[model samples]
Target: MTKKRHAEIAGAGFAGLAAAAALGQRGWSVRVHEMNSELRAFGAGIFIWDNGLRVLNAIGAYLDVRNGAFAAPAYETRTDGKCLSFQAINGPGQYRLLTMTRQHLHAAMVKAALAAGAELVTSSEAVGATPEGELLLADGSRLPADIVLGCDGVRSRVRDSLAIPQERNKYKDGIIRVLTDRTGLKGGEWDHVIDFWAHSPRTLRILYTPSGENDLYMAMMAPVADTEASSIPINPAPWIECFPQLAPALTRLGDRGRYDVYETTKLPYWSVGRVAIVGDSAHAMPPTLAQGAGCAITNALGLAVALEETDTVEAALELWEKRERPLTDHTQRRAAEIAASRVLASGMKWDDEGLRAARHIPTGAAMPFVDAA
Candidate 1:
């Protein structure tokens, strides 16, 4: 009889959960450790493109996500209160896109991973990792496994512990994301995702997205240097003056909104020996392209597929990075470029180029795996 392989993953975010589900379905024993007392997603809303949807489907989480998410018919852009462009996103050949609260997506992923037999350990923190496939816990203990994965965000202690060469760049622009009630908000434009930009008085931007049926996600973007616009508890005066149409939504903002500055993380390589880095720990990029979660989910599943094919853990890590890094790197570069320029061009060619990775089929999407009953 063969011994079952075990994987110890740090962080219970999108990357960690996806990896857990993928590996558990392949008959591996998986344990995910999260630092928080309970698993919770931080962002207000998230975009799941075609590539991400395929990963969710392969992991048997798509049905849950679809039931709670909103599929926008089109993507619209407005500048200075004037419509700049409106592109249909639900056409026959177009890739699928869905918007949902981070909480909703996280819940669905948790259900899928749990159903696949992955154990979740909360209030446990992983401080570091070793190349010998050992996870270092915060309480002066080490857990050994066949593989160790660091899906812990930008400040990944696992990645740092391995001394992986990397660069972290922080951009000047940031966003305040809040989820508001959708009740009583009236507008036909609410059916579509809208990007409202104000480049005149200042570089203020709002990304309006409908999530589920009762919630609206609004991301107010402004330079970090702009004290008034970037302040917490968000002053609705400036925003209302700029986007009068969104007065209702803006006024409902609470102090609990999250503010995050744009950042890009580039690692020379994603792994060392039996330990591998995934998601924001390896390649965190600007949200301009909204591919952060998508890329994370894709790579996590790709890692599981590589391990199934390779003979050793180290070899599988190498193969996974080789196969997945190119596209991820390209996506990061494109996202950074768009963020720096602050200009979003609308057209089929532009959209195709920007979303190249979103159209690519993930490694395990076509392969068959045991579905969780």
Candidate 2:
């Protein structure tokens, strides 16, 4: 017989789909709602570390994630074209550092959730949610469940409905990504490993990661002192000067332009009663750590594991929050530290014990140095 407990997930992002898939594997009936008519990824590149991959394996989708993804062994940090350190992602040829398009990952998760028997409804228009798992849709219809997982993102309507108090601040700058394919980069124990470069006195930072054979992903972020700085179209020297190896790639990037950046305050708590917030709704850190999606995946993993350990939804949610909070708090703080500086902020060399503070394969490359905020 099917269990009476049901989990309603708001948002069809990596976090929501992950939670649905994980819960379904644990014998819970799951349904997911996305306001959009179609499920899609952000059209960017994302790095998934071991922690996230472990969670995907728990739900039996690790290989699905591996499909259409690149296997990157290590990530390097450089300044003035000098290698400061090279951090191995998973070790040689292992499933270590990896990159995939947002769309690919989204499709993979959708497949995993459906395979686990999770019902998904797009264009459902979730306007709000209740602590007892009732979701009010745009059509004035209400759906009931045993629990709700709000993965609605930074401006989550579910989080607002919960009256979850939060603080948000905008960054003076943003990032723009340029996909560079087939640099034909090879050889060196670190051939084709991730490249992160910063300048001395550090005003610009640049990063390069191979998406697949002959294809690379590039991101450039910088601080904006002037509101119209993006429109000004200044020289690239400040950001790319330290890494001459990228001269050709920078020219290829050719001013793809800018996007806005912002981060929210880490919430005081992740859940209220049976409804809990996961992913960015719970803790949003700057992209400097690249843990946003990875952490969200972990939150889904934690919530599902907690449910399997207890009989009640409330107990499970509480346990999940309790177990995941410290690590998330640590992640947020460390990312903030990176965002707070411009002088080559690489935590890769942190003492072994301090590694927990680093997010999985986090790197912010090719952007303007962040001025003190």
Candidate 3:
């Protein structure tokens, strides 16, 4: 009898957990090791576009994640409180967008991954994967697996162990993210996500979206230099001057954190030997596109499909790389373009192809089992 395939996934973030859930559902014995004693979630939100929803559906966490989300039919762009473009994003349920807190989505994914029978080991840090198909844990013990997946995120030690050539670029801006309950905010759908832009002093943009239950996610983007000055006021007075619409949400800032934005070019290659990388470990982009987490989810589904189509570990990794690399590379480029435009209009070069392909993502979309593998 053939032995059941097993996968070792490092980290318990959305990508790791979702990939675990996907592989476990496919009859693969999956073990996920999280470096943190307990998974930590920031008081922030995420944009799960239709493309991402499709992957969630494939992994069996779509409905549960959606239950705690607010789906919006429109994406509005505003300048100085005046609506510039209110684009209707209406589509079939699969082609819609959902906004919710990272905590809720993470919690749902955790439940799905556990239910799917993926073993979750906490406080376990992966040292590296061996050529002999063994995963070296920090405690000097080794876990055997058919494959080792690096879902350990942007600062992935697995990716570092591969020693592949990679490029890292920092955006010229930083973000201030805050989460607060929507106690007194009025008007709009309350569930809607809005992008409000400001032109005076310097180009800046703020995103407002619903997070969890009665919670709001807001992030203000500005030049990194402007934010470096300790004298610069951290309050909302100047922001309110730029865009008055922010007054309602800014009045209730309960928790906040500063985010330094960075985008890394695609890795030279995502896999070597029995080890391979996924999610931000492969491509980390600025939030300008909001597709970081989305791509992670899809990568999980695609990798699972590749595994199902092939018997050999090398072949499966190759197929997974071929199918996923191009998409992620293009997404990084597109995200860079969007980030440029957000920072300064002079760098406005859009990815028309990406926009078109993304519009048709379906609710039941799953990775295809191509014969090439």
Summarize candidate 3's per-residue lDDT along 1-373 as a digit string, tens digits: 8778999999899889888998998899999999888876666888887688777777778778878787666667676656665655546542467888888889889988988999999999987777667777889988888898889988888778778678888777767766777776534655556787777755677787766568778777877666531112356666767766567776555335655564665688888888878888888887777788888877877788788888888998898888777767777887776676563232212235445325535222654412222
Candidate 3 has an lDDT of 0.75
Pairs clashing within candidate 1: none
lDDT of 1 by residue, 1-373 (tens): 8999999999999999999999999999999999999999986999898889889999989989988799888888888877878778866887678999999999999999999999999999999999999999999879999999999999999999999998888888988888988866635778888988987787789998998788899888888998899888788888888888888788778676867899899999899888999999999999888899999999999999999999998889889999999999999999888877787633122466698987879999964433347
Question: How much lDDT does each candidate structure score?
Answer: 0.89, 0.71, 0.75
How high a TM-score does candidate 2 get? Answer: 0.84
Whole-model lDDT, candidate 1?
A: 0.89
In terms of lDDT, the poorest run of 10 residues in model 1 is: 344-353
Instruction: List TM-scores for all candidates, in order.
Output: 0.96, 0.84, 0.89
Q: Lowest summed-lDDT stretch of 10 residues in model 3?
A: 343-352
- Candidate 2 global lDDT: 0.71
Write model 2 residue lDDT over 45-111, tens digit each, in one string.
7777666666666666767778678877667776556677766666654435567777778888999
